[model samples]
Target chain A: MSSERIITVRALTRVEGEGALHVRLDGDEVEDVRLSIYEAPRFFEAFLRERSIEDVPDLTARICGICPVAYQMSSVHALEAALGITITPTIRRLRRLMYCGEWIESHSLHVFLLHAADFFGCASGIELARQFPQQVNDGLQIKQAGNALLEVLGGRAIHPVNVRIGGFHRLPAAGELTALLPKLREARSAAIAAADWIAEFEFPACEFECEWVALTHPDEYPMNAGLIGSTRFPAIEVDEFEDHFEETQVHHSTALHATRRERQTPYLLGPLSRLNLNRDRLRKPAREIAQRLLPQRVIHNRFLSIAARLVEIVHCLDEAIESIQDYRAEGEASCRYAARSGRGCAATEAPRGTLYHAYEISDDGRVRRAKIVPPTSQNQRQIETDLAHFLPAVLDQPDDQIALSCEKLIRSYDPCISCSTHFLKLTMERR
Target chain B: MNTHSRITAVLGLGSPHGDDQFGWSVVDALTHCRRALPSIHVRLVKLRHPIDVISWINDQTQVHLIDAAVGCPIDQVLRLRCKVPTEWRTIECLPAKGTHDLSLGTVLGTAESLDKPIESVTLWLGPAQQCSPIQLMSARTAEAVDACARKLEQTIRGAGPLADPNSHLTPQSVPPSARAGAVTRAEDFDGEMPDSRIDLER
Candidate 1:
């Protein structure tokens, strides 16, 4: 009989916020593991109670600087639903383009800076650059192309100021699209090259059983719009999401933990989920790339999550350029929205995974009730599951090495703890 | 990458947390004096780890690093302008590699590593009291940010292109408006609220 050993990583690296890991071992038998969140939660929902809906996008963007696009998209979409307004086709496309930019920016940053750092045995992206300057430069330029897309489409790249309830505050002229052609072309090559490069990375063979879920659309890879669901069921509508899933709140985090209602377990969401659930929906070119890179099958190997992200980045860049080329300035900048009493739910694919927000707004437009479930929340349980399973196999590795491996596992999801909790606590007493 | 040159780089740090964004508050406080000076081409670079400093810089020409240091006193912001008079030492990179994967400090380290000619580099670290992983800044940090911005403007009034580690150069006043297009813009990116805004509550 083999004896078990245990190790713990007090904190993880290559991620947005802070988290620690704990494991139990018995004679080489992996037992229990808990991924603990140490970062303080900023009560975004609580602080948002009295604020005007107009400010919600900017405020919520603070949830995760990395995934600002997701927060803005979710909050804005909810507001649009609550106000009962239909935005223009151009506006819809514009939002999608902005989302594409975000995905590209985030995914490229992760592949080069976080995940690749792990495979290359480097402390960080900066360290990785020393060994490979051109690779780092390419990654940066790729990131810049994504940022440039956001800058032109959404105004400022990070926490863009242009996206509004109806459409952009000011739409760029057609000329702007041409200016991006050269860069987009360069980024296209970079994305493909990056995918090929990452494909060459050594991946540990490990797999787990968790439900894969994401938004699915009939026409294209789901981004700004979709119905909530997983490979487990026909795609469920957004409002029905509550019926299919549940979030358990605890003192450990301001964000709640989410589990599928049917399975009472954490369902997979994010790049891998979307890729597996909607592989066919990717645009023809993107589909061709995916076909070359990924065989037609469900990838449960956690390390392949990086591959999924690269494929998605390529998908977004292609769409971003196409959307910009098709952008027109004819539509009214915005539509009038009146306050109404109703419940609204909206979901968007953040760089990491799925982000959902539901709000109850009064006739006067004040938020009556709010529930935000960031992608990271849904994956927290899954990460814990992976740790529990992984501990037994890698018990002999150095503690730091083990911790880094675990960090890579988590980072594969690109957890944005900052996005998961957006509110800051005042912590004051009248006394 | 020149790992040998002691080039100086200046980084202006501020927090978007609450009003702590006021670290950029001095944007408007300093009056524009020399609007005619042509904009200079800076190797605007960012990196995640201090180790990459040598490669990105190729060769250093006075590098600058800017960021908000957490837990600082408000309105009493200090901009420590000094040259790291020693050879490049390996420094640990900040977590999240900084908000942008492209951190100013990381780039400099790369420049120095490649044997670039970086005469001197400066870090503009504003204090952020809460210093929570989130960007939210404490009240004191906000005030300090504004004070620091103002002080930066004052210091630059006679500060010329800093080339030597010990040279005392006069600042050539450039009108803020002329400094507009991306350059001379603060990394903190504080200024008037955007002229155009989307009605977020559609």
Candidate 2:
């Protein structure tokens, strides 16, 4: 007689957006695993059709509230590429600064409010806060600093209005940028403390034989611009993305799953991937913090993603402070560009991972076609792969503990199902 | 009343879809009418998610939250005064599912667990207008927006609850007629209200 069991979580809590995990087991042997993302399709690609190239930044920003800057940045870069517009160094630096704000806020929110509870054996951040109020407060303060930066740069934190195709509608005054320095300085300390605090958490020991992919720059850590590279593949230009990767419609999920076209295998893309590929590119304090937290240099344990996120937060804060301190307003807020018939693609490092945006604009500046491969969709296959590799070790644990661990593993990726979902109810079955 | 510890925060939680924009519309209306209440310092926050209310209420003693309550009568306005739980162990009521998963009640419950506990919380809720094409508020929901703002003003002024016999109004007393048609067009509110609706097929 074959023994069988089933576990189901109707709604996954703590993580942004909705999704579910289903695992099948026959006795002690794992049969199958799936991360079904049921977030409703927003038809963003279709919506972009016939829309003016200028509206791309603002429209795509709504894809995910947590990482709107990522969308805006990716869209603008793609549109600029199509229009043959090159923004000044000032605009580029400011774009990086804006991205830093997103990374800080998003990483802090995930590390403290979302993923911290998993390590502490709590159900939610609310439960974690009850035990560690000071930690939660510190996290909130750090998040606020990031939000303050967003408000200063983009005008609002959630969906910023300042981002434009060639540049910005307005540049921050030197005084305005200077005022944020002190707060960022304070936040830098807070982020450092946070990194120290999260470094102490006991992470589960697990490693995968999967490809790690991220945007790689020559001089600095990838944020606004870089070439897509992975341990398995050579650096590829943005336009070569669809040639290397393919998004397929899976029956179980509303989100389209992405894979490397050559191998049709799962690849990891996120903090772990970024940190693994661009560890040397991180700035001073962040580099120091990364060394302290991840002495091994390459993190194989997926659970230690919280540590990577903390390291990135430190990096972003440091970068933000430096950017603000060296603030210089030069030239027009945005350069003039004429939209012509062309195909353009851009890949940028979102808070989660690399976000790829491709657009074909008509001669009249209207968007003819658009394709967006969000990080979560790209990570979906890898998530399922991780689960298949991860569950075998914890098969003997209590079912509830197993479920909790599964949720933790998923959240470790900081999957923004809100962007990919058109969403999770976890279910486990043993037969 | 010590002004330092007393933070009167008004959070309008809504999306940019039809009547769901009630909370945001009400707050927009209050911004124009805020000059009338000079004695109290009110912090107005426009939020897309209910969980955001937690961050907005930091160190705030009195908080007024406005949101659209779906399934309620089209023109009805529901106001409830909430009690902040002092202890983490005490399980406060969670928010009902509104436009988002993290409801106002859930945020407040989470907020109560934090170090800062709000003393008084008033929720101003109006009917969610169900309409296709998703642009502005319906004429009915527009009226509810104005009434919601007026109620907030009245509450801020400490007008002793403005006794009302309406059944929809709870925790605070306001006249039945006070919940009448108070509306504003979406065009009147500045800033883009992006439609948050997604086409989902199960």
Candidate 3:
């Protein structure tokens, strides 16, 4: 004889956007798991059709408030590639600095506010703050420092208006860039403290075998552009992304799940993947911290992602300060370019993971086609796969406990449901 | 009262979509009517999200937050004076569905938790229906925006609350003596007002 029970979390809390989780089990055997993203499909692709190429950066920046820089960087790079425009070295350095701000802002928010509470068994960051006020305050200060950089460079913190297809509408004055150094330096100390603090959390001893994918740059940690590499494959250019990977629609989600085309296997992205691929490229301070904390070529435990995020935050602050100290006005705010019919695609490492943008532009400077693959969608299938492996151990607990455990696992990925299909709810079933 | 001693920040929180732009419209109206309240040094900030309020109101002693509210009547205004951390959680005007999951109320709670130097907060809310197609405010919403903005101007001037029995700005608009201190519930003032707290963080 067999008994059946079902567990459901009507709405998930603490993560960005909306989403839900469901698991079905039969007599202690995990049958199926689903990370359903019900957030309505924002037809940004269709919206870009026939729009001016100049509008691409600002328009795509609207996709996610938390990681707008990711969208802006990817769109501008892809459009520049399409128009065959090359940016100056100074402009390239400034763009990297802007990305550093975003990574700091985003990673700090996730590590302290979103994921930290899960470790302490608290329901929300506010709850965790009651016990660790100083830590929470430090986190907010670190996040504010990042926002300071974004405000100066990107125009406004959320959905920056300064970025254009070629470069920027205006370059921030040298004083404006230098003024942020004090706060950024403070934030650097906070990030290091944060990494040390998070390293103490007892990460659940659950490891899974998975392929990690990220952009690989020879010189520095990859932020803007590089060869797309995965643990399973050597490398592929951004143009060959579609050939190697494909997105497929699943019945339960509005977000399309992405998998490697040849192996038809799920892949993971975000800080863990970035650290595994580019650990040696990290700045000395961050690399030293990573060595002390992780000391592994590859980490399979998803929960240690918070550690990776803090380490990256340290690296970003260091890079941002260096870029500001070496600042110059250069020749022009932007590179001059002519619109031509061409197809181009580019990928950048978003705070969350790799963000890929491809565009087909006409001779008239209008967008003919557009495709954007946010990292959350690429990791959706892998999230479900992780749950299947993660659920059996927690299945003996009450439904609510199981639900909370599942949410903890999901939050480790820091899935932005709004960026993917949009929202989340969780449910579990037994038969 | 010396207005300069009290630095006030007037924050209009809105996205540029349909009626949702009420917060921005109010800030714009306030900026245009600055001459009327010359005695006060008010910082008028237009913000896209409530979380931004944390950074925008860094040194402000008093803050007036105006935004479009769902679940209320179209033309009516809901007012709340936030004095404590818990008061912010009860005022259910902000949405938590987006990527930035921090609602206005949650952000206020967070602000207090982070020990931000915000002494007092007064919220002016007008009803909202749409959020898309960009920058198109309904006529009713526009009227509500002006009324809310005028009320804020009067508040900034340190003028005592004025009574208008026919006004949709009710309860708190009457007087502090007549209503409960700061935390005025819509149900306490008008029977027709929908319990606007229905959609709060479920």
Candidate 4:
């Protein structure tokens, strides 16, 4: 019998947050594969125990610098639901547009800066620029355009200052939105061009057959709001999340690893999952591109995720342009929500995947408890399984090549552990 | 053509691993004077890569590329102009070479080869006291921040960029009166010192 060998990868690079990999080979038979996360969890739930409901947005925004809007959107929606308030159509469209901007920005950054570096043989974006200046510029420009959308809709890029549970604090002027038309048009073309560009790069042969889960919408392409389900499962409202899923702090990773309630195995979420699960949900140019380009309908194959993400970029651009044309500036930016004690839960399709946020609030509208399950944490097991299974076949390859493939596979999920759990809101009163 | 464009530019550089931000902090000193320079069509670029001074620039246009440069036993800032007569437009130690990037570089280089004029350039290098992923710069290199700031101020008054090499160098040169925690280089202390050299200056 051969000796068992354990190969471990520490501090995975390029993905949004942090995680590690451990592989144990028992005489060639894989014994264990763990995609461990060690990033310090802020325990926002514990911290939110006594915070006013109004502070939920601000507090959640601190959870991630990348997807603050996702958190904000869900949190406000949850609060509105608990308070028995409903927003107008204009606010909803605006919110959707803002979320679209996030999808564009986050996707661009991950695709061009983080993931592309792995394909191009660089440790970081700073390293990638030496070889390709215009590509970098194009990427950054796309990113800036997205950021511009966020700035106009929300307040800033990092921690957006606008938005509240009832509605927005202030709406954009007609001219401000009109000015974005040209940029949005340019972005629409760029998104398609970018999709074409990255699709041509040779992706490694990688695919997974595990269960894929994400939010699904009837009309929209599942952003900021949706019903959670998997390719093998039925759609369920946000309230049913805990009934079907479980999140536990595992020994391998710092982030709370999640799995199905009855099963011991982990599942996949995020772009690949959402794209594959909701392929029929996509509208127009995005749908056309996906139909023409995406490699089959398997989300398990990590490489296909690039095509999936590009398709998403195009979808966001088309949606944004359409939303911009129909935007009207006269709705109450927010509804005055009165604080009340209630158990609130929400599910929104973050740029990464289906993100769930739950809070138990006090009578004064203060949060008594909070719980969040990010997409990456749920897909951790799948990541390790992919790595463990793929390594032996390519063991003889150069280290750089192996590392590149591994990093690319990891980035394909767009693992946003922190931003996956964040949100942003503001208010003038204590509640 | 009787008229010639006197081009001027500024670049910001640093290793994501080092407190290389100081190299470009000079802009803060000149934010008050931006309009004065823009009237003449001066371009100011924010560069995160250390060695791309040649490729991202017009070889004939005067340039100022700032970054944490590797060299000198003690930490100190230095300013170097393109003195390499041949292939002056080519940057040193490029890190990435993907097909798309290579094509992009080729395009830029071809543009230069077609007489795009790329010779006049300056690099204001902020020395890394230590290059460790989590290490801080040497005391001497940290000290050069003030001197570099002052030097940049003086140069901006001349309506152009300037470099003062060795402004931050050895610890022995650091005055006893000054302290480590006081300067912008505190990040040097916060980050881990890297044993491996950052390659290709991407």
Quantify all predictions' global Cα lDDT against the true fold: 0.62, 0.76, 0.79, 0.61
Please provide, for model 1 over B39-107, each residue's C-alpha lDDT reduced to its tens digit, 9 standing for 90 to 100. 242233322223233333324454444445432223333222223322112122334323433344445
Alpha-carbon deviation at A419 in model 4, angstroms:
4.7
Each model's fnat?
0.08, 0.19, 0.46, 0.00
lDDT of 1 at A82: 79
- The full ranking of all candidates by lDDT, starting with the best, is 3, 2, 1, 4
Candidate that scores best on DockQ: 3
Judged by lDDT against the true structure, how good is candidate 2? Answer: 0.76
Per-residue lDDT over A1-431 for candidate 3, one digit per residue giving the tens place of the 0 to 100 score:
77888888875666777777888899889999988887779888999999999988988888887788999999999999988999988889999999999999888888887789889998766677777787887888898898889999999876899998778899999999998899999989988887667778999977998999999999999999899988878899999999999999999888999999988999999999999999999999999889877857788999989889888999999999999999987678999998899998999999889999999999999999999999999999999999999988987898998888888888889888777745357777789
Q: Model 2, range A1-431, lDDT digits (tens) per residue?
A: 87668887765666666667889998877788988876567788998999998898988987777789999999999989888999999999999999998888888877877788889888766788888777777787788888888888898766899999899999989898888877788877877887767777888888777889999999999997888989877889878999999999999889999998988998988998999999999988888888888855567788878888988988888888888888888789999887689989899999889999999999999999999999999999999988998999998999987887887788788888878852367799998
User: Candidate 1: which docking quality band?
Assistant: incorrect
Q: Write the per-residue lDDT of candidate 1 for residues A189-224, one digit (tens) a residue.
A: 887777667767788877876789888887879987
Clash number for every model? 74, 28, 12, 43
**Interface RMSD (Å) of model 4?**
11.5
Q: Candidate 4 residues B47-132, lDDT tens each? A: 33222343445544656655554432234454433433222222232211111122112323333433434434444545455543
Greater DockQ among 1 and 2 belongs to 2
| lDDT of residue A107 for candidate 1 | 81
Instruction: Enumerate the candidates' DockQ scores in order.
Output: 0.13, 0.21, 0.42, 0.07
lDDT of each residue in A1-431, candidate 4, tens digit only: 45533333433554544445555554445566566555555567787778888888876765665777888887877777777788888888898888888888888777766677666667656566565556665665666677779889887555676878787889988789879888878877777777666766777777657888888887877876778878777878889989999988778567776788888677788787888778888878888888777766565668777678778888887888888887778857777667777887888877877778887787878788787777667777777767777766665555445555565676677676444221001111100
